[model samples]
Target chain A: MVIATETFRPLVLAQAKARKLEPHLIVVKHPVGGLNAEELKERIDAAFEGLKVEMKG
Target chain B: MRIVNPTYGIAPQGEGSATAGPVDWMNDPIVLFSNNKPNAKELLLGVRDRLSSIRRVDNVDYIAKGSASQPAPPEMLNEVVRKYRIALLALGD
Candidate 1:
């Protein structure tokens, strides 16, 4: 699993391309620096449901 | 089914956009992103750890996108998505 902030998404996406690697990602709110661990976990956890759905496709 | 978070920028514009969509991982490979940020890594790792408990994902590959000089390479993205069934893009600001 991979996580990225909004601003860094382009960078992340580009890097993923350079190596030709495709991995699941969980995009959390930017400035994660502010969120406490628990809060960040919650955000990261939320992205999983979407992955779960995508997996079904 | 598709889920989009309208809160953040939905799509990139002007020399930085790609037509990424959902995929069926059961049939194809998956790739994750690492932007080289400590907090971003932590966040992605958190998701990776959580994913193990719910389902069995064989493996995930990490890729680099940009640096101080250039934006994400569009060609790289196009090539990466060509083989996969789905690409997960997270947007938060």
Candidate 2:
């Protein structure tokens, strides 16, 4: 599974498209870099949630 | 009247689809791959920490690119494919 922020989601899809793979992607918020640990916690939580959903389905 | 879409472009032609097999998250080895972006590893690590509740953390390993500006070597990717049952790649800003 690919974990990408919303801003970079299209890029992941585009690259996967070129590779002819329908990627299992987990989209989080944008700007994953430059964030403090507190700020990044949200993204981590979102990623974990996405993974659980994928794992379940 | 016709308006051109600036974001539109011809995409590369794909030869065929590449598919990954279903992963047994609890038992199968999973690689948390980072593109070497700042905090990308942290994000994946955080996920790993949380994932421990559902799966074995010992089977989950971290692999990262040497540099964010450079593409990952084919050997590195090959190694992941050879060793890991699943990969959770982080690609971000």
Candidate 3:
């Protein structure tokens, strides 16, 4: 599974398509690179939600 | 016609991605793979910390490449696949 920013979601999708993979992707908001721990929590929250969905499925 | 060996001298019994049966996500070993961008490690570690609430984080480990510019080499990826049932890869933009 890939945890990618929303801006890069298409990039992940494109790579998965090329590889013929049905990717498990968790799309977070953009600019995760420089966020502080506090700022990063939201992205982490979103990713966790995505993961739970995948796990349940 | 000419043939080229793309395995780079790796002993080729057969080369392909390994497939596993269904995963027990809660109990299986999971690896947090970091691309080593600025906050990639933090993000992945955060996810792992959350994972601890529902599962055992002791079986989870972190492995990182040296740089974000280069993809993780195949050897490292192979080792991770061999060692863990699930890998959560952090992608940085």
Candidate 4:
């Protein structure tokens, strides 16, 4: 389910813009497990259309 | 200047703990930030998905926290700036 809101979008977007960075790589981590740096890096290169399938199942 | 939504990560930290560690970058640029509090995985993942599709940023950094959290370590933020060179740091809630 898409949970992004108008308020959060601008904040996140503005952060990226200020940094002069490109929006491509996505890092996913749990509070306890930390992050699987390798897996997260892989997601960045994964196609957007396939992300849901890969992430969910 | 462009607006882009990028993926971020949430990792846990102890009280007074410093530094999140070295980040492994994808074939894209990254901006590392910190997130304090718990149960932030779903929210962060959703944000990442939304931002990755944008044509602006190549990556995002999200630091996670536990129930009782502390501010991000200055060294960590400094490392991010030193490593990435350009970054937008969001600390606390």
Best of the two (3, 4) by lDDT: 3
Error of 4 at A7 (Å): 12
lDDT of 4 by residue, A1-57 (tens): 111223354555565565554333222222222335555343333323333342343
Please list the residue runs of candidate 4 whose C-alpha ends up more than 4 Å from where it truly belongs after superposition: A1-57, B1-28, B56-58, B65-68, B85-93
Per-residue error at B29 for model 1, in Å?
A: 1.3
Position B90, candidate 4: lDDT: 26
- Segments in model 3 whose C-alpha atoms lie over 4 Å from true places: B1-20
Candidate 4 per-residue lDDT, tens place, B22-79, comes to: 3332333455343542223534454466656553444565544332366557777676
- Evaluated against the true structure, the overall lDDT of model 4 is 0.41
> Candidate 4 DockQ category?
incorrect
Question: Model 3, A1-57: lDDT tens per residue?
Answer: 899999999999887775556778899999898788889999888888888887887
Alpha carbon lDDT at A49, candidate 2: 99
- Model number with the top TM-score: 2
Candidates arranged by lDDT, highest first: 2, 3, 1, 4
Candidate 1 residue-wise lDDT at B83: 53
Cα-based TM-score, every candidate: 0.51, 0.89, 0.85, 0.33
Ranked by TM-score, the better of candidates 2 and 3 is: 2
Give a tens-digit lDDT track for model 3, residues B27-78: 9999899998888888888888888898888999999987789989999989
Query: Scoring each candidate complex against the real one, what DockQ results?
Result: 0.26, 0.80, 0.53, 0.08
